[model samples]
Target: MKKTRYYPFERNRYFYGKLLTVRDFESEQKYFNDKRRLMNRLLHGTGVITGLQVIAVDDKSVSVEMGAAIDALGREIIIPSPVTLKLSMMQGFSNNEYAKNVYLCLAYDEKGKEPVHSVANAAVRSDEISEYNRMLESYKLFIREEAPDPSVFPIESIIEQTSVLYQDGHIRILQRTPRYVNPGQLFDVTFVIEKTLQAAKISFEFELVGQQLQAEHDAKVTFNEPQERQETEYEVTVKLRADSSSRGKATVGIRQDHAVLRIGDKQVSLSSARANEVMIMAGAVDKQWVDDFVNRSLEDSLDSPSDPCIYLARISLLQMGPTYMIEKVDQVPFNEYVYNASALHKLKSKDSSAPATPFSGSITARSSLRKIAGNQEPELNVTFNKDKGELNFDLGLPEVQSGDQVRTGVVEIPIASLNKFAASPFGRGGKSYVSAEIEHGLGRGSLFIYTGIEEINEDYISDILSSSERLYSGSTDVFKGSEHEPSGPDVKIGTVLYPQKGTFRIGVRLQQPTEATQINIRWWAFKKATESGAGSDDTVDISSLEAASGREEQA
Candidate 1:
């Protein structure tokens, strides 16, 4: 309020106090208008042209000659021929502001026979027209010196010689022996050098390139200076690594390298070296045998008292090529075959051992009917020495009671011995039997036996004894305590049994009891009659059994 005498504001001092404000606004507007006009001219103006000429033309490419152009700054600039041609072929030029300006400055003549020229004119103080004319004259002279011929070509004749002109020497794989090979076997590959220009010392590198098999081999051979038109064969042996995982066809490549031919004092190096390829199939593992072996190993391990035994198993090599239906099946011995332990172990564990020993055992059968009713149950004791291959069994039945009119005898059997017997004659698919001879007993006696994948438990044993139709049932004759018959109705009956992979449980039940009862038991393995008119006997001499027992003790 101090008389409202505030000093004059800065804005007022410039706008009102300065007498040149109107002139400043007018100058600013003129400057903007000039810029706008220049932009419009650059975008829409059609420029002048001095000259345009074609340099050369061929099937593959075309060449052209061009002159200089004036840029937006009113300066003369020489645009390269390649840049000009590339800009002409480029797409989407209309939508681009800068590219549109360049297009306007490079507008061609109405007849399309002259080169595009500069957008700047004489009013812009640009001297590009004179410069462009001089450049055009020089370019025309250059084009005349580099012009293409005008003669026509005969395309048919030219195409006829294309194959001969491109003919060259190459190496090819001819043959592969034993196209199918076992995992651990060697592979033989043959290659041939065809139409090579010169004789060279060739060295080959063989490689099995695949995800499963990556094996490499190198071999060198000297080729006698090859004759003018003779083809030479080269052979190389490559060992395939043993692997079960590498199954099916594997890619094998053979590369020719380090080839040089010597002529007098000069060594001519071979060129255009190439590689040949062939496919070799790896053998597959027998899944059936593997499964059987694994199951047997596991069962044996569980049954062993000490450390598990490792049994050596044999695997047969499968034949290659066609198999005729009439071809006889070969029954080769087990010891002659090779086994794959790595594959077996991979399926299970390494704790298993081989089945090296022959099955052997002794059965001591005894019976009595004089014992009390509570003591009717039979007793059994079994001992097996796998290291020395010995098995012994002691079986005892209840004593007979006076005037009880019953005959009973016990027949002990070793499971290993039964398995061997079952596998040989029954052929692993047929039924097996146990035959026993009763020396002395009284009245009629019933017999029973048990065979299964697992051991015979007490409950299973009781169930068999209680059931009328036992797992295995038969009849035996009773005899006086001192009566011993070689062969008669008093003899022990043969009981049929099924042994799975040569393993089962054996049980015998004699209904009547006698004090002087003795039973001689043996395994009847084959279904066919033997020369002795009886199934093949599995009996061993007493002296041999003693010797085996001693050896087992020592072991």
Candidate 2:
């Protein structure tokens, strides 16, 4: 309904209360800003000369020289030759081909006593010396750690190129080759680079081909186990000189302090490096000890709860896991409902029983259960399509007394009814799909029937965020408003409320208003895979409805 504007420069100006306009700036200020911007663009653009260079650099000021030409009046004139071009080309253009003309004149000038020289040979020699110095500075920075003084020397670092190797068991090794020129002044120079690694090994070597030289290294790694939760270290050293000779060495350090290996179904504690992906290890131990442990954990599963809730919980544990053991279940705070006529005006489900309290109580619920429990849980088999934003519920009611009434609540199945006729396995937050099937019992006739899932208020949504355990271990919570709000409380019985997910329960108060009858209900689970997309890891399942009773016994 409303909007706000945030200015980027407001924070730094501190002219918080005062509105300032850039248009109010003086002409000189604007001119300076524009000129600064242009210079920055030209200097940063590919290969533009900055009019500075290094002939050689020591710990202090580096050898400085301007690559310019002397004019006819003996004044030095600077020229612009984009550095992206070759040094020989830059020299040729900067010298204006005067060196070639001088070479021709030197042949005739040597035989004459006051020769008419078209160009100066000294100028050509000076240009050659300056170009050589540029090369010397280039290689120093590129091949060695020696940095030419930026104040006097202007040589850009050579660009480093890299290549990747992905073979021999998922290893990703990168090799970088640095470009540099051979400085004729330097007889020799050494280079050292620092690297970090884990419990892996790496080595380096160098090769010289005529005037060209190169260095390389080999790193072999294994990731049979998860890398240690720590850091590792490594180093590389290179030696070079103007004679076109080169040497290199690589040193690796391994750390096994916190290695952990989780391959397929096996989880082991090991130490390794994050970069390593290959491993060589010893044999497999096939013993019943592991099987015995697994069997023992499942053997006492009956000691838990034997009710349908437990069955549902067990099924959920099966479908979704690392089943957490708790001393007692924590009940989220939900307000108990009393009949509200105004709110019920929004319940539009056609399958819901006729509203008796002048109010509708059909609040939609989305149940969440693990797929592994589909076989044991009857609700997992029932199918329903989410088409046109409408839900089709199958409400199957069992025989009951004339005065019987079904108590209603959020995720609360009548314990007595479940104990009597809950044929399907249910879990905490498990939904019971009551189809439209009518019950015909002793002395009772068949009634019109419908069954399946039901929809209530669209206000509630269930959020299952990633948990700290396995990918499948996540907690289910309810939320309101755009599915972004944190869950506040749960829905209370008899209260018109919305649940984030699960089965919707509506109390059907017969017109005769009896409380002595039975209502049988059944529900199943459903699942579907999520489509591929960013930030999503497929394999997501939406709950389904079905009817089959399963039990979970406590140990």
Candidate 3:
């Protein structure tokens, strides 16, 4: 099989007076064969196009299933039937000095090596023999260590076969992973091979679309929370695998400039055959998608068709403020209200912003209050009703908002300080009322109103009084501010004990506020809680309070 030689013009030209020699016939045959093979190689590029699976029939033999393929030299190879070969009987095994792999290929044999006429030429006598054969080139299988090229003695050339170690029982990816994955996110995938094979030899590839991390550096393997490791080889075998399995625990890790980002554990057990819930940490894989997607979603979802758009549009166009809530709870229920109604259902708070704030009642309201400017504070006129035993409070401002200047305020009035008036001489007569003035101005706001007076002996400040949170105004100064938060009482609000401080603050959004805006606050007088009353602290006017005489008391 010395390299078949030919020139572009070497093709024989047959005419009425041309010599018809064997060499001329052979050269013409070579030209067409080479041309066809070139098209097969260039158009189809080599390898098994379909159905060339190699299944292990035994420890010493393998079965190559029927298939069609193209070879390196552009030959059409069609295995009409499954072919089985004994590995030890292969010619390459005995002939080659070192047998690494045996390639079983399809080739064109013109020597009549395949069973047909058993000889190259059909000749009656040895002296009168013909060089040209009557039989066509036969397709046959050949086994060799290194496949033969055209220059070989008898070229056994065709497409390469599957590796003997990597056929049917060799490797298989058992799990289907998500098609699209973020670069650092953790994802689970399982691949398997026979028990005796070195697992690391097989390639377990992960795809990170568009982005490539430096190998052995940016990419990482993790069993759990990833930690930095100096060792380049990251592997830890978890016990429990099938008798035939190469499955075990391993880690994939990469170097993070900050820390080792790990892909979670790859664990397998035969009984379960399923890996442990061992988190396949896809850290960077998962992280990239999270950073890209988390914020892309809405903070809150709405059910209405236009609801998402409605909320988003309002915030963008109007520059609207977030909805806030305030709760005013009365110790005593209304005279006609259901007993212990609110106490029946005690729900836990999610401790986050809800899409729509529902009114949770023991007493609760969601409303907006202005962030006030401490300058030009509103005057609060607090008057106690002598007949009704009710106290009324009014903090008024004529023009709540104007051009540029702001008018926001924080006012704290202690309940115990107001106790200076003592019990009103007039008790329970006419009903005092509050006018709903700014009720319409409350856009997405709500108010909870509760009012009551509890009689306490003053001798005992019960558990309620000892362990409650008293409040005071938040900073009124918009720029130069007072303290905004209190010392304690996180879960508890507006609890009273001899009036350390009491809560009162008015807040409003300064984004082009109303020219004549009013806020209606349903009053909550906390003179009571868990069976106790309010009292304490402030300078008293001795001159305004005259000591009563026996005759003066009657008058």
Q: lDDT for each of the candidates?
A: 0.29, 0.23, 0.30
Instruction: Estimate candidate 1's RMSD in Å.
Output: 38.6
Tell me how many clashing residue pairs each candidate has.
25, 82, 35
Provide the RMSD of all predictions against the true structure, rounded to 1 decimal: 38.6, 35.5, 36.2
How do the residues 319-371 of candidate 2 rate in per-residue lDDT, one tens digit apiece?
A: 11322111111111111112233445555335445444322332222222222
- The positional error of residue 285 in candidate 3, measured at the CA in angstroms, is 21
Encode model 3's per-residue lDDT on 335-386: one tens digit a residue: 1111122433433334345444233322121111112233566565554323
Candidate 3 local lDDT, residue 444: 21
Give the residue spans of candidate 3 off by over 4 A. 1-9, 94-110, 113-555
lDDT of 3 at 499: 23
lDDT of 3: 0.30
TM-score of each: 0.16, 0.15, 0.27
RMSD of 2: 35.5
lDDT of 1 by residue, 1-555 (tens): 001111221222245566676567655654554454344323322121222232223211223344443222212223345422222233322221110011111221111234334564444545334223222311111101011111111111121111110112222223232334344333333333322222233333333333234342334333443222233233333333324445555544333244444433455443433332222333222332344344553233222112111111111111223311111111211111222346556755422354433443322222111112335686655654343233434333443323212223445532222354443322121223343332222212222332211112246754676532222223322323432212211222335433322222334333333222233343323221122232222121132232222122211
The positional error of residue 353 in candidate 2, measured at the CA in angstroms, is 99
Candidate number of the best lDDT: 3
